[model samples]
Target: MEWTGARYADKPTVEVRTWVNATPERVWAIVSDVSLMPDMSDELQAVQWVDGDRPAVGGKFVGRSRHESFGEWSTTSHVIEYEPGRTFAWAVADLDRPSAIWRFRLSPKDSGTQLSEWMQMGPGRSGLSYAIDAMPEKEQKIVFVRMREFEQNMATTLAHIKKLAES
Candidate 1:
């Protein structure tokens, strides 16, 4: 991802995609299972369903994350979109004005699947907001650094998923 000098209010986003040598159904099975994410992610520590056992548009989940710089924190995410074998998305903190939004999209390509993981941070307040508030002059720099971290992490996640799906 290229630097945009984004600020928290800009709602910066980062996405990473990979072609998996597996069917969309196979990829969907993995992506939709939030329980599997903590293992694939570096910052995410755990995830548990709050309302239901499986993915649903109105369901909720709590995710525990730990960042070396920011420390550990948890967030409740509401599932905003759920389309079997195609898309899965959730909004963190608030349904109407989320602090973050995350998504997974899958599409058939050739004999495999094209899978994408995307996330957008903040039109609403979040932990990062505290950092920005403390260093108001460096808001853009902070946002840029965080966005890059997300980009790298998302790429690692996709690579892990690709390995799992292709195996």
Candidate 2:
């Protein structure tokens, strides 16, 4: 993935895709399982269902993430889309004006599944806002760095998911 300086309210984003040698069901099982996320993510340290029994449109979850530069923080996410074996997505904080939107999409491809993970950094105030506010002159630099981190981490996550699902 290469940075193109895509922006939303001055925030950049990263999206990565990978083809996994497994069925959509297999990929969805891992992708939609919030309990399994922390293990697959580099920044996410933990996750838990905040409401409802499992992931569904309208469900909520809390994610705890720690970064070397940003330290640790937790955010609440509200499920905005949920389609078993196809897609799962959530908006972080202030559903009406979210700080971020994250999604996973799965599609059948050559007896396997094509999985893509994407994130859009805010149209509203988020954790990154603090950094931008602190260094207005370096806002673009900060977003670029964070998006790069997200891309690398997303690749790792897709690799781990592919490994597990294929096995």
Candidate 3:
């Protein structure tokens, strides 16, 4: 990914996509299973449903993650979007002012599925905000670096989902 020079208040985002040799239904099965995420993600250590057993609009889940710079932390995320085979999204922390928003989108492509994972950093405070607050002058660099990390992690996650769906 290229430098974006984004700031936290800008709600900077990153996305990664891949074409999976499987139906949208197949891809959706994997993407909607929040419990499966920890295995596919580099920083996510665990995830558990907080309200319901399955994905649904308004349902909630908790995710535990670990980052070299920020250490380990957990956050409650509320499902903001859910469309069986098309889209799934959740907002971390406050829904009206989320620290982050994450989503998965799927579309039929030829005989397979086009899948994309997207995330927005913030419109609210998060662990990274502390780092930025500590070095106000380097906010841009901090946001850029974090976005890059998210880009890389999202790509790896998509690759894993593709492998699982295609198999």
Candidate 4:
């Protein structure tokens, strides 16, 4: 069935936040260190630096991501916004549409730094994501049974960051 856009609207796009038990500055030491992602993420297979310095605004990097449910996906991201210990955002592009923005904002609180991770998927990206979400209903459902796995993946990744920051 061809999508009429309702399925795209049903796709859940959300930000996952956690109160990290460390200062924003401390957390930035990890998140802003772009080279470390492959080691921390199970899905990001590799990051090949394209130009400019690591984690700087306007820098570009190409990477590959692999998931059991989605196989391999590739994209190059350009840093859109960067602030020392407060925020950083990037746009991943070159597939079929505008791009998706991944943003992280840090706010200091009494408990620790509040880490909010935001993902804004573009038009076609949302539709494509909904198609993935719809894959489990087919007769042979083995293809993308865990299609929305990024939700859990991001949660776990954020938890890992919390753990690393605390100790």
Each candidate: RMSD: 2.4, 2.9, 2.3, 4.8
As for candidate 1, its clashing pairs are none
Model 3 TM-score, 2 decimals = 0.96
Off by over 4 Å in 1: 1-4
Candidate 3 weakest lDDT stretch, 10 residues: 1-10
Task: Give a tens-digit lDDT track for model 4, residues 34-77.
Answer: 67678778988888768555777778888788866467888888
At residue 64, give the lDDT of candidate 3: 99
Question: On lDDT, who's better, 2 or 3?
Answer: 3
Candidate 1 lDDT over residue span 53-155, tens digit each: 5699999999999999999999999999999999999999999889999999999999999999999998889999999999998888999898999999999
Question: How well is each residue in 48-111 modelled by candidate 3, as lDDT tens digits?
Answer: 9985656899999999999989999999999999999999999999999999999999999999
Candidate 4 ranges beyond 4 A from true positions: 1-6, 9-12, 94-97, 124-147
Total backbone collisions for each predicted model: 0, 0, 0, 0
